[model samples]
Target: MQARVTGHVQGVGFRYATAQRARELGIVGYARNRDDGSVEVGMAGHDDDVANLIDWLQTGPSAARVDQVTSEEIAPQSWTDFQTG
Candidate 1:
């Protein structure tokens, strides 16, 4: 799944926190800061895990003021581990 998380997502450790959460859920992918002040996440794993991650992305870390999270299914991609960039 790919998600574009909006609103106060930058500079709040959102990417790093996402990486941590993904690791906890055993999801594999990456999270990065977008130029548009959103955070983009690409996560792949069991269907349940992906869904869990998307749910988490809506609220993010304690400091994050997440306004929206838009996610969609995409063609499967391979990732050995979750990362932040």
Candidate 2:
């Protein structure tokens, strides 16, 4: 699934935390800080794993005070490894 998470998502190690979370879930994709103070993520995995990821986005890391998380299911992409970009 592709998630276009927004609000208080940058400058808080959100991208790094996302990378670790994605790895823990055995997901393959990329996450990056968008220009508009939001973070974007693309991930591919089992339904449950994806769900768990989506759920975590709500709380984020200790430094992130996530105001919202928007997610949409998209066709999977080919990524060698999850990363921050």
Candidate 3:
């Protein structure tokens, strides 16, 4: 799944926290900061785990003031580990 998280999502450890959560859930993908101030996260894992991550994205880290999280199913990528960029 691919998710775009908006609102106060950058420069606040959002990507790092997301990578940590994804790792704990055995998810493999990446979390990157977009130029538009949103965070883009790509996750591939068990359906339940992916869903769990998406749910967490709604609130994100304590410093994040998440206003929206939009997601969509996508072709799974061959990622062996989760990363923050």
lDDT of each: 0.94, 0.89, 0.96
Q: For candidate 2, what is the lDDT?
A: 0.89
TM-score of each model, in listed order:
0.97, 0.94, 0.98
> What's the residue-level lDDT of 56 in candidate 1?
91
Candidate 1 structure quality by residue, lDDT tens digits, 36-69: 9999999999899999999999899999999999
- Candidate 2 versus truth, CA RMSD in Å, comes to 0.9
C-alpha RMSD of each candidate structure in angstroms: 0.6, 0.9, 0.5
Better of 2 and 3 by TM-score: 3
Question: What ranges in model 1 sit over 4 Å off?
Answer: none
Better of 1 and 2 by lDDT: 1
Instruction: Kindly list the per-residue Cα lDDT of model 2 for residues 1-85, writing each as its tens digit.
Output: 8888877889999999999998999988999998899999999988899899989988889988888889988876888889898
Which candidate's lDDT is highest? 3
